[model samples]
Target: MMLFCDISLAARIERAETRLIADSSDASRARRGDTLGFALPYAGGVASFAEPDSPLNKVAGLGFEGVPSPADVDRVERAYAACGAPIQVELSTLADPAVGDLLTGRGYRLVSFENVLGRTLDGFQGEPPPPGVQVRRSGDEEFGPWVDLVVDAFGHADNQGVPSHEDFPRAVVENAIRDMAATGAWRLLALRDGAFAGGASMRVTDGIAQLTGAATAPEHRRRGVQSALLSARLAAAASAGCDLAVVTTQPGSKSQQNAHRQGFSLLYTRAVLVRTA
Candidate 1:
C-alpha cells in the first residue's frame, strides 16, 4: 500500500500525539499531586509538563498552526522554566519550513530525531502468533506483573545501530507506564508457553492507532514475542475501527527494523530541538 507524508496527514498525526501528551500531563498531575504537571495550548498544539526530568516536558504540533510567534516560544519557555526543565520542541519535518528558522533563532539546538512509521489497517486482520507464543490484553489482575516484566525487559534490552538519545530510569519508566494506561492506553502482554515474555501498549484516537511501545525480556529474545505482541495489537486496533496504526522509533533501531518487516513505512521524522532552561 502507498502512504504519503503530506502536511495534512502529518498535522493529523501530530495533533493526535499532542493531545495524548496533554492528557498524560493531566494524569501525571493527578498521580503525583504536582501542580506544575499540566498542559497549555500554544500555537495550535500543546506544551506539556509531566514532571521534572520527564521527556514529555515539551511542546508538540508546533508548526501545524504556523511558525510560532516569538511571544509563543517565549511563553512555552517560561512555562518550562517554572518547572526547571528543558523545553523540548518536536517539530515535524513536514511542518512549515519557517518554523525551524524561528526555533533556531531563539537558541533551540538540534538534539535528536525520531521516525514515525505507519501502516494502513483497512481490512487488515493480523495473523496468529508463532508456536508457543500468546498475546492477550492486560488487566488489573496482571498489571503489577506486566509492568514489572516490561521494566525489566527495557532495562536489559540490547542496543545497536544509532544509540538511544534518551535513557530513562526504572522508576520513571514505571510512572510512565501507569500514566499511559491512565490516559487511555491499552496494555497487552505476551507469554511464551504461559510464562510472561513481553508487554506492549496501544492508544487509539480518531481512527488512528498509536502503537505506544513494546519490549521483550532478554531471555525471551528471538522467540517471536515482539512480533506476536505487535500482531495482536494491530488486530485489536483494526477491530476497534482504526484505519491506521503508527509507531515512533529511534533512527536505525531494532524497533524500526521490526516495524519495517511488519509493513510499516516511514511517515515522517520529528526533529528534536531543545532549549535548556
Candidate 2:
C-alpha cells in the first residue's frame, strides 16, 4: 500500500515539475534579456540559456508525459547547438523509461540525481525565528548582499573556477533577482544582528509553490536559520493560496532531513543527462 501511494505521489510530482519548468521558461522569455528560454516542440520540454557558462542553460520537463523519439533527441541537439551551448537534459526516472536508453544511445552521460520532496501546506505551522534573527522579503537594493551571502553559503564557482562571491559579476546577480521577481517569485533574506545570514526564493504556480535558492552563511549553520526561512516561506506560500510546496535536494543530505522533519515526504528522483557540444 505504501509503495502504491509513493507511485501515485511520484506521478503528481512529475506533473508539477513539468509545469514548474514551463512556467519558469515562460518567465525567462518574458524578461527578454540576455537569457533566452522557450518550449521545445519536438522534445515536449523547455530549453533555456541563461549564460554561456551558467549551469541554468539546459532542457527540462522532458519525458514526464511521454517519451521523446530519436527525432526529438536530434531536435534538442540542434536547438542547443544553434545557441552555441552544450546540450543537457534533466530527466525523471518516473518519466518514460525509454528516455534513459534513448539519451544514452545518443551519447548523453549521467550527471547527478536529485531527490524531489513535497509537503501539503493546508494547516501547516512554522516556528517563529529564534531571538536576534529576522526574516523578510528582499528588496532590489539588497540583491548584492543577498547574492553575496548565497554565493558564500554555497561556495558557487564559475566555469573558470572563479569563486562567485569574489569574481562573479554583480550585474548577473542583479539581473537574476529582477528576473525572479518579474516572474512571480519572491526572494527572502534572513538576518542576525542586522547582518545577512541566509536567503531563499519561492515561486508559485497552480496552487503549488517551489522553494529554491536556499543558502546560509557558513557561520550560521545549525543556528536555525534554514528552519526559520522554511517556516516563513511555507506561511507565505499558504497565504498565497498554495496547497503544496516542493523542493529538491541531494538524497540523505541535511536538507532532505530538514524537510522530512517539517512533514515533507519523498516524491521522486531525477537524474541529469548531459551531452557536450
The candidate scoring highest on TM-score is: 1
lDDT of 1 by residue, 1-277 (tens): 7577788989999989998888887898889876766699988889998877776677888888877777877877877888788888889999888989988988999989999999998888777899999999998899999889988987875686577667877888888778888888999999998899999999998889999889999988888889889989999999999989999998988888888888899999999998888
lDDT for every model?
0.87, 0.71
Off by over 4 Å in 2: 1-12, 15-42, 156-178
Which runs in model 1 stand beyond 4 Å of their true positions? none
State in Å the error of residue 268, model 1: 0.8
* Count of backbone clashes, every candidate in sequence: 0, 0
Which has the greatest lDDT?
A: 1
Please give me the total number of clashing residue pairs in predicted model 1. 0
**lDDT score, candidate 1, position 239:** 92
Model 1 residue 215 lDDT score: 94
Candidate 2 residue-wise lDDT, 80-149, digit = tens: 8877777777777677778788888888988667777888888877889999889999998987777677
